[model samples]
Every structure is written in C-alpha cells, then in structure tokens.
Target: MTRTDELIALEDKYGAHNYHPLPVVLEKGDGVFVWDVEGKKYYDFLSAYSAVNQGHCHPHLVETMTKQAQKLTLTSRAFYNAELGKFDKFMSEYFAFDKVLPMNSGAEAVETALKLCRKWGHEVKGVNPAAGKIIVCDQNFHGRTTTIISFSSDPDAKDGYGPYTPGFEVIPYNDLAALKNALKDEEVIGFMVEPIQGEAGVMVPDADYIPKAAQMCKDANVLFIADEVQTGIARTGSLLAVCGNCSCENKCERQESYTRPDILILGKALSGGMYPVSAVLADDDIMLTIRPGQHGSTFGGNPVAAQVAIAALEVVSDENLAQNARKLGEMFRSEMQRIIDSSDLVTKVRGKGLLNAIVINDTPDSKTAWNICVKLAENGLLAKPTHGNIIRFAPPLVMTEEQLMDCVSIIEKTLSEF
Candidate 1:
C-alpha cells in the first residue's frame, strides 16, 4: 500500500537477492542524515562504506555533476575529454603523485594496481617474466573479482568461485616476519594490503606494522601497495591512512609512522559517493609499465566521473572533513569504550576515525549485531554488521558534535536495551 512496501515488493519480484540490505529504503539524504520512503529520519553511519566522506549529496559535487552532465557525460578513452586532464592534474597534485590511472570502481583500481605491479615486475624490476607473485594479507577484503577473491581467506567469498587464480601468496596481516618470509621468494613482486582492513571489520594493525612491512618490501625490491578504498579520503581522519596527515604537515611525525605505498589505490570517496571513480597512483616506473591496450574501462575516466571526482576531492579539503572525522571519531570511540567497559555483552570496540566496530560475544547464529542494527534503525541511526558478530559504525565525516553525541546516545541506549 505504501511506497516502501511497493519498493520492497518490486525488489523481491525483479532484483537478485545478492545483498541483504536493511529494511529501511532511503529516498533522500543530506549531510549526515537520510530519510526513508516512509519519511522517517536516520543518521547514516555506514556512509555507503566510506564513499560519502564529503557527505551525502554534497552541494559542490552535485553542482559539478549537474554542470558536467549538462555539458558532456562520456567520451570514450579513444578521444581525450576536457575534464579528464584537469581532474588528473588535480588528483596528482592533491595526492603528490607523479601520475594517475583512472578506473571505475575500487575493485577496478585494485585490479589495475595488481596488473601494474606484475607488469612493473617484468618490465622494470626484471623479475622472471610472467612469474611474478604478489603477497597479500590474510583476511583481506580487496574486492569481489575472481583474482581478488582467489587469495581471500574468507570461505564465503571464495566458495563455488573456482577455479582460482594463482601467483598470490597469503601472509598474516601486521606480521612483519611473515611478510619477510613471503617476500623471500624470488618471484615475489609486491605486497598488497589494506592499511586498515575495512570489510574485515575495521581491523587496525599494530602501529608500526605498515611502516616496517613497507621497509621490508623496499629492502626486497618489492612494491608496497596500499588498497585505501575504504580507509582513505579522511575516513580514518587522514586523507590516506598510510599518509597519516591527509591534509596538512602538522602530523608529519605521525605520517612518517606508517609506510607509504608505492602504488596507491583509491575509490569510493573519490567521487564522494556520487559516482564510481577509482584510481591507481604511482611514480613513473611503476605506472608507466602498462602500455596502451594493457587494461582500461569504458566508463573509467569519463567527463562526468572527472568532474564529480574533482568536486569530491575539493569537498574533502574545503570542509576539513578529516579533522572533523578525527575529533568526532575520538569522541565516538571514547564513548563506545565507556559503554564497552560497562556492558558485558560487548567484548571490545576498535577502529580509527569514523570507521569503527563493536564485537558481540554472542555466537554468529544469534545475529546479535543484526538485531542491534534493527534496534538502531528503530532509534534513528543506521549501521550494518560486517561479519556475524561484528557491527561497523562509520558515519559520514560531515556530522556535527551534537549529531555525533546523539548517535552515541542512541547506540548506548540500544546496547543497554540489548
């Protein structure tokens, strides 16, 4: 009878049941909040998996998209578009990279990085041609592609998705010794990992792990690639988590603490959750190895994507979302810690910036996180469980202190009820 009911019915009738989305069907959003078709308001804690770092329907990004759409949307890679060059220049300058290769999704950027690394191994590093091996972290969440999933430790991601691709060696995350052991093989070309495993439930490694791992890779002539699709763009209160200080030099010491990736992969927030625009950034040698016809996407670097991305990056800088995320994230984590200390149901709360998670001691079959999320939905906050017993709470960076406190209160109230 209602619009929400009609939408659900239509989805059940026509859509494939791939994702188990929450019951609420959001019809509109602004900044940190979204409204459902039923006209109920809820704070969006997930931010579409850290894509809306600039917040939902950011005016700048929307304006850019609208203006660009009116002028031009697509012009295949065969011919250069006006916006693409400007966007590439802006991105290179913003990230301090020599060059960038654009793609459509986080997974595509990741795939591009993999290809680039392998090609660089053969062409520049002079490793055995076609024998390059990339060392990946165990419990990694790169993407859903066959090659990405082939190295996945999660059974659900890889099940029935064989025959798998090879040339990947899985090593335990944050363990410098294991990474050293994996790279001892002459065929090893690079170490690919998420600075913080986002989909693995906001898993942050040891403070010194990434820097040490990067040093080891550098010593072994292997590239250190950071897949920062979820952790980058101020999601972790840094422009790139590996970069430490995403927007300024005040945190130079902190920036130096983490290992900077040789090849940087970014997506999601790159377009401010407006459109899918991912990219691979590298210095000349690693990025240039891929010649024409090696790899590309038709919609990868379109005019619309270019304009949207430029606006998105601008919003991240102009709004100071990183600093906001840092301050609010600390407040959130502290509040959650207080709750965790008091509650017996929650085992721990862990994460950086707005990207956070709480572990439920209950069994997976209990769907504790799911039940909590349903309660959270009823309380006007939205979040989703990553795994069985872990719930990820990552709100957009544009949230105010009052909004964050309100969200914290909602969470506290919900947890108390549980």
Candidate 2:
C-alpha cells in the first residue's frame, strides 16, 4: 500500500469512527495551500473550517507561541498568570467587551456563554431557576457537545445523544416574527444565534434580520448572544459577523448596520490555528454573574494561547483580513455566478465574504457534491460538502487577488468535469 493508504488504514484501525473525512491526508500547509504526504500541492479551500484565517503556520502566531512557550505555558485558573491579564485587557479592548471568559475550544466557549446566560437569567433577570429558556434557531451548528446537540435539527448530530439537555427553545432562523413572538415569554432570557450559519451551507440571513432582532431583544430585555466561533475573526468579511455591512479593520464601534450582541462567543481563528483558544465576552453587568469559582478551564488562559491569540487578532487587523475577505468575497461570488449562468451541475452560489458555498444540482442524499470535492482535490484545490448537496468554499482570508482568480479558475475547471 502507498503511504496515504497506510495512514488511512492506521486511522481506520485506531481512531474513532465519528468523522467522515475527505480522503486526502495533508502533511504540510502554508498560506492558502497544503501539501499531502506525497507532496502534491493544493489550494486549502477549507482553512481548517476557518480556523487558519491568518493562513497555515503563520510566522507571527508561531513566534508568539514559541516565545511564550519558552517562558511559560499553563498556570491554570488556580493562580493568575502574567499573559492571562494581558490577554484579558487586549481582548476586552479588541472586541469591546468588558470581560472575557476563556476556554479551550469553540464548544467550551458556547457552553460557557450558555452558562453565563442562565446565570444572568436567574440572578439578574429574576427568572425561576428551572423555568428559564434560551431561544436557538433551527439548523444551527453550534457544536457537537450533548447540550449543544440537544436542540440540533441535524439527525446525525442529535440522534442517539439521549437524555439531552433541556431549557432551550427552537425557532426558525432569520424569522423576525418568530423571534418577536418568542420574546413575549417572560421566561425567555436570551436569543442565541450565529450571525451567519456557516455549517448549514453558509446560510446568510436577510440584511435587516440581525439588527432588527437585536432591537427586539433589547425591547424585551432579552440578551442577544452571537455565536461567532465559525464566522468571526474576519471569516465573514468583518471583525465580527454581527458587524453587518460595516467594513472597519479593527474593533468595531457599532456602525449603522452593526448589531452588537450582549454576549459574544468567539473561537477557531483566535490563535491562528496554532493552539486551542476560545472566549466568551460580555459586559460587566452580565458577565459578573458568574463568580471566580463558578466556571473555568485548566488551559483556558494559558500563556501560550494568550500570546498566540493576541498575535492572531493583530494579524487580522494588521493584514486587513476582514477587508480582504469582503473584497474577495464579492469577486468570488461574481465568478461563481458567471459559471452558474451556463452550468447545469451548480444550481446556486450564496454566502458573504470568503465563507461561501455552491449547491450541487442534485438531491441532498446524492454523492454528487462529494464526488465533486474529490475531483476538486485531484485538480489542485480542496473543499468539503455540508448537508450532502452543498459544498462550502472558505479559503484563508490572506489570499491575494491573483491567487483567488487562480483558485476560481481551478474551481471553474473542476465544475466543468461534473
């Protein structure tokens, strides 16, 4: 067997069968590209699910991690570390949140945010402890944790995860009326949503949906929680997906379209894919509800992760990744539309910024999208399918215009094969 086949066999023999990954086994990665074990190069269209927004193995993040690693790594929450305070101050000013609850992964941040919401509900909102409910949208892809999967519409993630956590209400995404009606419940303490549903095939809501929803939540005293784990850090052409059409390069100051969330959950690109780092941010009134001993992670605010995250956020701003994503996204969609105009295989292309997707003209159960992805891999590009029929195409935001057009050409050629 070949090296790729041997590696695949080893994984099949030892690893858990939870993930159905694409066959390619990558070994090396740089900005917008990866090479497999055999050294065949391909454009990295997935960007580790938008975790490597600063591009793979970024020098700044590597330097920060390495420098911090030489000094210290983890001190846990038991004792305060030097980098943690700096991270707290930097992130607070970076995202404009009064406080931050650090965690190791995106799921942990979501859980932390949920716990914070529940705590705020009971302590501040005066809701009965067991009676409070947070509203979540249908087809949301928050995470795979049992509590998060409880309200999931996807059968694969939800089924068999029995005795699921309760206290969450399901509402249709982007439906203002449903949100308005749901807010009428006095027990409703928060509305948790993704500014752009990334995993559900890059679903973008109406232009007015987010701002209007925030206003409604404000009117009803409900906390507007934005889970920007997948869509944040310049993925959706903004510092945060909730920034709306505003294209500011740094921490947003709430422009006309900016829908500021009361509670913000961030992850993925926080460390530029060098280390695990996630954070939940909120103002003093909401975040202070959770005392010191209530919640924390051992490696949440570690020195390496802290410094890496600072470097990563700096990369986003310094490199103008958000602005790059915004400009390139428009270019990409227009190119995809040009292809779709004459093609029969691709029916639609939709998304904002670099986080985009193309719908294969086939049933969700069909293997068309998967086959296309395999072909895309063969043709020197890599992308993955979501919900079977939709193929998500999110590349690193550091890609230049020439590189993007080259990728577009590769995509056009690949689609023609179908």
1-418 in candidate 1: lDDT tens per residue?
A: 8888899889989999878898889999999999999999999999999998888898899899999999999988999999999988988888877899999999899999999999999988888876899999888999999999999999989999999998999989888889888888988999998989988888999888888888898999999999999998889887778865444434322454545689999999999999989999999888889889878899989999999998897787778888888889889999989998988989998998889999998986678889999999999999999878999999999999999999999999999998
Q: Write the per-residue lDDT of candidate 2 for residues 153-269, one digit (tens) a residue.
A: 999999988899999999999999999999999999999999999999999999999999999999999999999999999898988889998867446865666778999999999
Off by over 4 Å in 1: 245-255
On TM-score, the leading prediction is 2
Error of 2 at 73 (Å): 0.9
lDDT, candidate 1, equals 0.89
Per-model TM-score, in order, reads: 0.97, 0.99
Q: Could you give the C-alpha RMSD of every candidate to the true structure, in order shown?
A: 1.6, 0.8
- Where is the poorest 10-residue window by lDDT in model 2? 247-256
After superposition, candidate 2 runs with Cα above 4 Å error: none
lDDT over C-alpha atoms for residue 257 of model 1:
51
